[model samples]
Each structure stands twice: as C-alpha cells, then as structure tokens.
Target: MTEVELTMSQRLRCLVIGIPQATFPEGLLRPDEAASIPYAQLAEHLPLPDTLELVVAPLFCDDFDALEIIETLGSAGYRRVLRIVAPKLPNRQIVLRELRSHAVRQGITLEMVEEG
Candidate 1:
C-alpha cells in the first residue's frame, strides 16, 4: 500500500489506539475511516504510522501505565503531534505532568481533548 499509488482524491489515514472496534463510539468515525486497535494488538500493528490518534479512558491512566504508552509511541517512531481523545480525568494534572515529559523526548506534541 506504500508503493505511492496514484489516487484521484486525497485519502486520510487515521489509526486509533486503546479503543476496541466494537465498543468505539458509533457516530464519531465510520467503519472505513479509522482502525481502532485494542490494547492487546497495539504493538502488533507493524509499519506503524508516524502519527496516530489515541482514544483512551483517562481512568486507566496512572503514572506507570502512562509511561508505558508514551514509550511505545516513541519506539514505534511517531515523531509528530499526538491527539488524545478522552473524557476529563479526576487526576488529569498528575497524569498529564508525567506524560508531558516523556512525550517531549519523543518529539511528540500532546493535544488532549475532552471527548464529548
């Protein structure tokens, strides 16, 4: 697919992490628009895209888990901004602080959006 094939119109490739296909919100994205990879299959999707949109539950993010996610993104070679979509977290400040540092070292700009 990376053979530089010609297309009449531009295509938008969006890869979603930390969300499962079945449980993913319905109206937000169509079946073909994005691929929602569950946590188990995260590292298995090889030839990883340089950019990805992570859809994770903030409640699941603690200091250690957040670090693991950040390291995986770096190892996968995502050198651009990462847009994270999730609901507000009770301990957002603490988690954000931890992630911010690791994200910076990976050359990743973290944009957190409160999902509706």
Candidate 2:
C-alpha cells in the first residue's frame, strides 16, 4: 500500500488602515462605474496579502489617541501592525504618528508600508 500525503493552508487576517478617500488610475472608471461597486466587492477584486491578521481602529488624524483600543486588539489576536501610507496623507504627520506608536507599552510595533 502507498501512503498519502496532504498539505494544509493557513488562514491569515490583516487590518486595512485609512480607507482612501480616492482611488488610483483616476478617470479610468466612469462616475457611475465607480459608485456602483462596494468595499466588499473591491476586496474581492484586489486580494489582501498573506500573513495579515486584522486592522483595527483606523485613526484619521495623527494626533488621535486610541492606544487602549489598539492594545486591546493587539492582545486579543493581532500579531502585526501594518501602516498604509498614501499620497493623500500628510507625509510628515504619518512619520510623526508612527514614531509616537513606536513606543507602545504593550510592545506592538507598527510597520509602515508605502504600498498595500
């Protein structure tokens, strides 16, 4: 008899911070076409990367303080913090914000990525 081998896939979750007010390739889609699609629909078209956990409490302002909420989420199930940088955001503010969170008491570090 021959032995059978099998492989298992791991499920990964990732948090998407800062829902962009606008999208790239502007003017490519007609206003009607753009307005027709929903976030869930968009997610299907553009799949998230592997090894992501969850994105919690998107802070619009760099000065917004939500450490408790963030820490709670991090402790619950989150393993990594992924920061999304977009042209619409203030570059200096983002950098400063990242620096502030770098000193998290719970030892959570936000990894900033230029692109999703």
Candidate 3:
C-alpha cells in the first residue's frame, strides 16, 4: 500500500485591535454589526501586515494584557515571530518598544509582526 502524507494547518497569526468596548454605541448591536465596526476602525491603525492567518479579534483590554501574552509566549520558548494585531491606541508605540526590549532581554530572537 502507498503511504499518505499529512500536513498540519498553517499557524494562525494574531490580529490585535485597540478599540475598547466603551466606544460601542448605547444601542444593541448584532454580532455581525459589532464585527464590522472593528474592521472599519482598522483604517485608523494602518501599516498592518498584508496577510493574516488569524485575528486576535475585538480589542485588547489594555497594554498590560497584550504585553503579558507576549511575555508568556516568550518564556515558553516560542522563538518564531509573534504578531500583535492591534489598532492605533495612545500607548501603541510604548507597547511595541517594550515588547522589542523584552525580546532582546529574553535572547530569543523573537520578532514582532504588527497588523492593525
């Protein structure tokens, strides 16, 4: 019998959004409607990666939450590039800088890919 080859699915890339839930209107929004809102907000946070396998969805609670995720991955010996998909937030730059610095400190050659 001939052997068959199996391949794993492509790893999903993260898509972090910066919009907070507080910005949502007071009226009720359907699930689809809420999803569309974040896509529109992406324009404000341009320069995102052209292709994304997976999206972080909605928005990060705060910078700390984002950083913690990255740090945890780093500590786990995940050396591949880590993508942080987030919208344009006030502390976006600061967060990126800190992440880069943390990667350096970890000595893991962890590159951060951003997709807003």
- Provide the overall lDDT of each model, using Cα atoms, as 2-decimal numbers: 0.54, 0.39, 0.41
Error of 2 at 40 (Å): 16
Q: How close is candidate 1 to the true structure, as a TM-score?
A: 0.60
TM-scores vs. true structure, each candidate:
0.60, 0.34, 0.38
lDDT of 2 by residue, 1-116 (tens): 00110011123243333353435356553322222122233233233333444343333435333453354444544445534343334575765476447435445555444434
Instruction: Count clashing pairs, candidate 1.
Output: 0
**Which regions of candidate 3 fall more than 4 Å away from where they truly are?**
1-59, 62-64, 108-116
Task: Identify the leading candidate in terms of TM-score.
Answer: 1
Per-residue lDDT of model 1, residues 1-88, tens digit only: 1212111112324555554432446787554445655555665565454333443423243332545666777777766656565567
lDDT of 1 at 15: 55
Q: For model 1, which pairs clash?
A: none
Error of 3 at 113 (Å): 6.7
Sorted by lDDT, highest first, which candidate order results?
A: 1, 3, 2
Candidate 1 — which residues are off by over 4 angstroms? 1-12, 21-33, 50-64
